[model samples]
Each structure stands twice: as structure tokens, then as C-alpha cells.
Target: MSCSSSGNEAFMPDDIKEKIHNHPCYSEGAHHHYARIHVAVAPACNIQCNYCNRKYDCSNESRPGVTSERLSPEEAAKKVLLVGGEVQRMSVLGIAGPGDALANPGKTFETFGLVRQFAPDLKLCLSTNGLELATYIDEMVEHNIDHITVTINSVDESGEIGSQIYPWIFYNNKRIYGKEAAQILLERQLEGMKKCVEKGILIKANSVLIPGINDKHLPEVSKKLKEIGVFLHNIMPILSEPEFGTRFALDGVPSATDQQQMEVQEACGMDMKLMQHCRQCRADAVGLIGEDRGAEFTKDTFAGLSFDELQIKYDLEARQAAQAKIEEFRFFLDQANERVRKEKEELSSDGHTILVAVTTAGEGMINQHFGSVREFLIYEAGDKGIRFIHHRKVEAEYCAGPDGTNPLQPILDRLKDIKLILTAKIGGCPQGDLAAAGIVADQSYAYQPIEASVLKATRKYFNLPEEMEVN
Candidate 1:
């Protein structure tokens, strides 16, 4: 879904609109065209959440708090220049970590300073637990860090639910635990968030939906976030796998289902603008939200590169021109998508919705082949319009050398609920398997804008006219 459809754009000020115009995580439309990079410069956290398990040199996992490598402020600055030069669409530089950005203020601010000096056009963002956020508001404003994300799970005030999620917190030079710790943390979070909002920084609150723990309580959290003038709220599913070693995972706290997440998002969305496209990116994540390219520019890749060489590559005018072209394409794409949304509303029948999956490598287009797809961006399409629901990650590419196992079966199983699959191309054998499984696979809309294509496909499947009157 695009940001304008949220119904918040009508009331949003011009400055806020400009701030999120090109920010991938902030704007749903920009995510396809723009990219962000997070540097793991801070490796220290103040609070302990039940769902967190920080790990280093961990390239296998894609969730938050996992980084393959940590860098100093100088190294991070150099890497930013290199990536910005290579990936011209890269626009934001965030310092979300294997730890809290606020916990290591020195490193976080230093990195922000260097980036500001060398690549002033790149927007700076920081994500934290909000423990030390109030303390660094001045520094944040000084560094021109206009975007901030705070993970706030509960707002129960009494600290009942918060205590269950957080076992302990190290505050005021002491380890505080239980209800008291939760209360303190919540107080600080609120105070800091309010201060940041007052400073005109766009705040996006992230809440992890733990099934039985705080699922029902999230609506209240969302309401409170909206009351504080938060720009967006993201309800993310808890990733509690046994191998990651999070406290909740070890205790068998099942992760939130996609349905459960959607339900909560529906409830919270009534009070706050919801962000449904988060990829739960890693600390050192690079490139687009759906794809990571950190390994392509590791420390060793630019070992001997000097500051002057990297700076020369960071061409501001060239980046601006490329971004302008992207904006021009999006302007036309948005007009096309708006027509689809209107057509969907007029072609309503019994409020029925069908799930559709698209194979994409970012840039908001169905550009990936079926066999090479590592992930499928799932969308719910119907008379209500197309909305992104989930990101399903497959274990391995279908074309990967087989170990005598039917790769097609796993792909089928994963997409069993899907009614249609939209991709760039599909093999004849796999296409047959998908058709036999009652799933329709289509490649006619290859590399097309995802939402318009999905809605058009949905209309075609339901026997509705592909085009509607432009009234």
C-alpha cells in the first residue's frame, strides 16, 4: 500500500511529507525505489527483552540484532561513501545495532558526524530501546538525525505485561528487574519520544507481537503512540526460532502468525498509521529492505581505499539526478496504481479477498524468476485494493543443486494458501506442479509495478473488466 492511502497524508504538513518522500522505511511507495543501510557501530544495549538475542558474525540470520561485522566510526563512514556511490538509490544511513543506538552514544554520534561531513545528502536515522534517548536528544538534533525508531511493546502503566517481556534493565549504574524496571523503561520511552516529536523528528514505533503475552494489549500501545504524535507504528511478528537462542524461543513462545499480526495491525491502524512492509532488517543490513548486500562491500573489499578516493565516488549531483528519474517513474506508476485501487472499489462482490504472491528483488516490481526466488512478497487483493501482508522466505533457490529432494514440494507447501503467483518467469515442470495444486501462475505482468499487476490479475481471475472508467 502507498503512504497516501493511509489517509494521514491529507493532514500531514509539507515538511513531514518531504521528509518521508524518499525514505524507504517511512514511505511505502519509496521502499521499492530507495534503499537504506544500517551500520553496526554500537554493540551495547541497556535493556533485556525476552525476544532479543544479539549475535555477531552471524550472516545466516536476517532479523534485528545480528551483524556479520562491527565497524568503528571511521570505517562506517568510509563504507557509507562506498555504498552510496555504488547504490545510487541508497538514501538513508541508520545506526540500529546488535545493540541499542543510544547505548553506545559515542560511536553512534561519531559515525553520524562523519557521514554528515562526507555525505551530507544521506539522511541519518537511529533506532533504540529509548532507554537513553532522552539523554541524547540534543546530540541527535545536532547531527541532523531527523528519523528515530523506538521499540515499545507495552504501555500497560502498571508494568504487568512489560515485566513479562523484559526481565531486567541496567539503568543508573545498577541492574533493575521486574515490574520496577518496566515502569522505569516505559517512563523513559514516553519522555524521550515526546521530546523527539517536539523536535520535529519523525518517530516510528515498533512493537513485537508476542502471541499470548501482549497481543491483545498492542492496540492500547498504538493509541498511546498516536497520542504522542508518532509518525508511524509497525507491528512486527516475533521471530522466536530455537536456534537463535532468544529467551522466548527457548521457552517455546510461538511466534505471532501472519493472521494474528494483521488483526492487531487492523486494530492499531484505527488510531495510528501502520507500516506493513518492514523486513525486520539486520543491524548491518545494506541495500534494499527485501535484499541485503553487506557482503558485497565488506571491510576486506575496500581495505586499501583512502578517504579521498571514497569521497570522490560520493557524487552528490549524480545521485540527485538518478533519484529525480526514479521520482518521475513513480509519479506515472502512482497514477496507474490509483486507477487500479478505484477500479477495485467499484468491482466489489461480497467483500471477498484472495491472497497473491509476487517474486521480487526489490524496486517494487515483480522482477524475479520463480526458480531463483529466495522470498515472496505476499499481498491480499480484492475489492478493497492490494495490501502487502507478509514476506515468506524460502530455504533455498529452486534451481540450487538438489540433494535428491523435491524442491518443488517445499515451494508448493509454502505457497499452499496462495491463489496466484506472479513472477518474471517459471519453468514448465514447476508451472505444472503449481497449476495442479490449484494455484495459477502468471508471468504476463513481468517487471510491472506489483500492486497494479496484482489488482489487474485479481480482476481478470474474478471475470471483472481489466479496465474501469476514469471518472
Candidate 2:
């Protein structure tokens, strides 16, 4: 169904289409590419479009809907490994977030880092609304992630249909939008694509065809993108159905049917993938080519995994097996805990308790906040499933409770017999001071009060999900 936008120039000209099909990722969607796994990073989007019914998370699907579950980098890496192994050709690592990926740069980059380290040969790809792409080009380049997908609906901001789709966009909260803002955004996205091409990043576009809205504008989009060096355009058919709820509201406007979709594809020189396998999966969705889930995908089907599948009869047997391994070689940890308990028994005083400092910011800034803080050095001293040490800080900043003489010091001196110090906040100066004072600052706790320091410390903080944030 390949046609042309400019009165039929070269609908995805053979050379360009060959480039796309030759790409490591263009396979799964078509028969050429092997497999694709899209990670849901930032669940928050900047501009709102009409056709986007995807929940903040593509992983948050309803039935096969995985719109709710967002995995950490560690978990995602593990899942990728499992899926890649199962599918036998999961070469593309991608992120089709509910929002844009640039917003979740840390999570996206961290996850990418671990994945690259764990599985180096996999090809990485990311799709964004193109709002923040300009800010993250260097980062993507550093990570060697050149396969990019930018979803651009229309190039003409003044057009009636496009204006309706991009009615009011917000920039810096003031909302400098209308036809003007949409026009500006379109230009910025084009500029971003140019920069991407200059850097050797292959840009694939996803354009949602909403009948009268953007369907006619595909030609200009494809033409402009081609001039800007976009490798391919994937003109997507609008999947908004009334039954799918309020995701994409058409009001009285009907959607593009198979025939209309094909017609639009022919009009634009772009690859249109609405293959039967296109389940409109969640951002963090996972699955085999023709399978529903669990039997093939763990995303919507993780809970279905039972002990029987793991070859264990009961949960206790699995626990015992692991427990046996720990006891055989790592019982010394328990013995060490006992020793610390005995030492604490010697002091037994409330005023001599150690302080715990877990932070979201990194050590340097953490120290900037707390200064020369000292507390009991905590290590993996907790066997309660979470690692941490109870420590004391002698800084006015950390206590958020009190200031002066580091009141926690007396407690630390009392718990001189205590094993470790685990605080919710930590910085570099405090780390150095604590190190000298036999106080260890370990951050394994979830610090809700100050997120920056906490996230910086553990590199594991998810910028509070918007749905759960305080406005």
C-alpha cells in the first residue's frame, strides 16, 4: 500500500524502505526484524494529542493491558534477558512510554546502561513525542543509541485539522500555544531530527492517521522529514475506539478502517504497520509473536508464574533451597549480627542510638547538605530483605529534627557495640567524616522527605509518579 504524499513522489522510496527493512529493529513489526521490547520510562507527557489513549504507562494494560506496572532498571534488564531468550530474536530494546522518554532520562539511561552491559549485542531504539529530544542528543550519542522513532502528526500548524489535534500546547507552564505554538513545536522537532541525522542517528517516524485531521498532511510530514534526513515514516492508523474508553475520543468522528488505512498508506511513502500482531501493547508490554501473555510474555502474566513452573512444589521448598545455600556459606553474616547485638547489649541505652542516612542525591551533594556528619557505619547488616545500617550524623542538616552537637552522637557512642549506621540521607563531606569516625552511611531505605538526595544516593529513585504527586 505504498503511495506518495507529494502527489506520489516515491512512497518510502525503495532505497529508504530498504534502509528501514535493513535496520536491526525493523524486523519484528514486519517479518524482517526479529523482535522488539518497549520499556515504559517516563509516564508523564508534555503536549497532549487527540489520538493518544495510551495510559501513562503502556505496561499498564487492562486485560492484556499492562498500563500499571513499571519495572526498575534491574527488573527490566532481567525481564529483557528472559524474553530475548524466549523469543530467540529479541534484538531491539525500546521504550514506548506512556509519556516521552526524555522526561525519564535517568531511568531510561540507567536501564539502557545495565542492558548494554548485560547484553551488548542488542540494538537500542527509543520513540518520543520529540519535545525533549533536543536536550538529550548527547546522552543518546554517548550511549550509542542511534535508532530513534519520533511520532510527528502534522507539519502544518495552521491547518484546521492539525490545529485541532495540537490545539493548546504548554511550554514553561504559560501555554504559549495555539496554531503558533504547534508551528513552533513542529519546527523544533524538525530541527531535532536534523541534528539526529547529522549525528548518524536513524530516525523512524510514527504518524497517527486520524482521517481528516492528519491523514492529508502525511505528504508534507514525509517530505519534510525526508529532507531533514528521517530514515522512514511509520504512518500509524488511529486505534481510538469508543469501547476502549476515554483514551482517544473521536466524539462523532469515525476511525480509519482497514480500507481507509491502506488508502492513506498508499498516499504517503511510508511503512504502515497495523499487522494483526499489532496488539497496541502497553509501553512496558512483552509478548511472543502470536501469543497472548504468560505462556510467552511475563508482563501481564508475571503473577501466573507458580512454584510448579519453577520446579518447586511449595514456597517453603524454594525458600529452603535458597536458605540452605545462605546458611552453608554465608552464616557468618548472622554470626556478625549476633556479635553486634552482644556489643549493643553492653551499652543498652536509648540516647546512644545510631543514625541512618539514606539519600536521593549523590554523596557529594549529600555531604554539602549534612557536612562533617558521623554515625555508626552500616553495611548489608539487615537481613530483613532490605540492606541498611543504623547510623548517627553530627550535622545540623540531616536530623531535619534537631540541630547542634549531633544529638545522635551520644546514641552512636552508646551503640558503639551496634553493628552499622543506615541513614536515609547522605552526602560526600558527611561520608568522609563518617568514614573516619567508624560511621558508615548506607542508603537502602525509601526517603520520601527529600527525594533528590535519596535518589542521588541510591540511583534508584523514580521521580514521584505524577498520579501520586502533590500538586
* Candidate 1 global Cα RMSD: 2.2
Tens digits of per-residue lDDT, candidate 2, 339-437, equal 222121222223233323432221112222232333222212111112222122232333442655664454444444433333544567555656677
Measured on C-alpha atoms, candidate 2 has an lDDT of 0.52
Task: Write the residue-wise lDDT of candidate 1 on 1-471 in tens digits.
Answer: 232223345357889889998899998778888999999999999999999999999998899999999999999999999999999999999999889999999999999999999898999999999989899999999999999999999998899999999999999999999999999999999999999999999999999999998999999998899899998999999999999899999999987766787688777777777887798999999998888999898998666798889888988889999999998988878776774442223335577888899999876688999999988888778754666666777778999836999888777767878999999999898899889999999999999888899988887878887654454
- Ten residues in sequence with the least summed lDDT for candidate 1: 1-10
Deviation of model 1 at 393, angstroms = 2.0
Q: Estimated TM-score per prediction?
A: 0.95, 0.55
Q: For residue 404, what is the lDDT in candidate 1?
A: 96
Model 2, position 91, has a per-residue lDDT of 51
- Clash counts per candidate, in order, are 0, 63
Mark the 10 consecutive residues where model 2 has the least summed lDDT.
379-388
